[model samples]
Target: MNHDRSNRVCPVENAGGLDNGIRKFLQNPRKILSPYVKAGMTVLDVGCGPGVFSIEMARMVGTSGRVIAADLQDGMLEIVKRKIKGTEAEKIVGIHKCLSDRIGVTDKVDFALAFYMVHEVPDQASFFKELHEILKPNGSLLIVEPKVHVSRSGFEEMLKLVRSLHFEVAERPKVFFSRVAMLRRLA
Candidate 1:
């Protein structure tokens, strides 16, 4: 439960102009996640910075499913709350303010997405352990980090931690300028 917050991206930067069209073009939620997500599945979007992917996930999950959009910053969650104000997605998406140690999610999830945000976490091992607990048996977690920020060695270290937690690598999807790994919890 280490709370080292030095490298975390500030809430203000979470709303930067770069998060608009350019970011969406490169990291389209539907294109990147369609392979793993299905209808009626509860999904968790960790470090969901402005509802960019959360909104799309809500749609992908449809009316029967749920998308927990969790972030450390209240401002970030506020942005997501505003984005889904009057849409159908609003009914399925839940905005959660998470802490550095705990994600604060009790419901078991079918899938989880951690995009470009794992590097910002202070304690990787503890984070993964919490994820393992919340995810259903055989559930999948997709972790994508910025190549520019996380080096090959760093990413490998992260993978080693995940493996130690008994998560097996299911696939390595090619994401533009990102190092990606999809892992599944052991039953």
Candidate 2:
């Protein structure tokens, strides 16, 4: 785990470093992702440091939905709190701090996000296996990483192993596309 950084937080508010202005730049993803996420659905943001993505997704999913923003850091969750200020977001977001491979979330999530996080894991297979089991059937997992951090070939190899567990890349949206490959849970 070369992800050496301070990891402490509480998800009582918005986390910055990903403000709403920058978040607006992510509008395209919301359009592409709306079909997979719906009101009343449960969503999980894995490695949800600072919880920017979770806050955004909370707005998109509406009041009836739930968002579990799990991270190994509580300070990041506090950052998320400062970002969203006062809004409907305060209630929709839940925070969990855990470093275990099986994220201690009880919700049957319709979607899971591993934004800029998978590469930092000390155990990739164990992480994915746990994610695979937690997802509801027809759920989806999207992973985003810096294109500079890992070679494209190395990423593809890891993705291949995940595919064996029944995940298939539904979209490959270029490096600029958050350097991510969105995978749909098929099994």
Candidate 3:
């Protein structure tokens, strides 16, 4: 399916959904990521939006680790910055503004979360390639897309693109109302 970057959801709407009380209950960051995340493990929260998961992941990573919260909209990053201010999570979480075609993350990460945002990317191939480059050896990436928004065929197409970059499917976790996949870089 062809998508225009301009058609991406606005930052304001994204913030509402990301931090909604019911949504958090349905998509608890801790429960969804506990198996893969550990203390002192550097993580990347791709398409971090208002930092709901970023803050939770920052707490999980503790002071020794870092969470890079990247989003294409400055407004979204600003919301993340505001949400984390005056909290312990602020110390570990870094807000980054990324471009449409490049993530521009320099640090290698142990884990990356691309939650409900991959379908919005204008260039999936380049995005996955860059992600592959920054992942540490044995690192994992978890991708979750809303089943309501993404059809099975479209999600399968994305999996094909990920495999083309030599990423191996490690697991398919069940997420409420979402299609989830855990992938590792092929050594």
Per lDDT, the best of the predicted structures is: 3
What lDDT score is found at residue 157 in candidate 1?
81
How high is the lDDT of residue 29 in model 2?
Answer: 48
Count clashing residue pairs per candidate: 0, 16, 0
Ranking by lDDT: 3, 1, 2
Better of 1 and 2 by lDDT: 1
Which RMSD does model 2 reach against the true structure? Answer: 4.3
Ranking the candidates on TM-score from highest down gives: 3, 1, 2
lDDT of each: 0.88, 0.73, 0.88
Per-residue alpha-carbon lDDT of candidate 1 for residues 135-174, written as tens digits (9 for 90 to 100): 9999999999888788888888889889999899999999
* Residue 130 error, candidate 1, Å: 0.4
Per-model RMSD to reference: 2.3, 4.3, 1.9
Report the CA-based lDDT of candidate 1 relative to the real structure: 0.88
Assess every candidate by TM-score. Answer: 0.94, 0.81, 0.95
Q: What is the lDDT of residue 57 in candidate 3?
A: 96
Using alpha carbons, what is the TM-score of model 3? Answer: 0.95
TM-score of 2: 0.81
On TM-score, the candidate that comes out on top is: 3
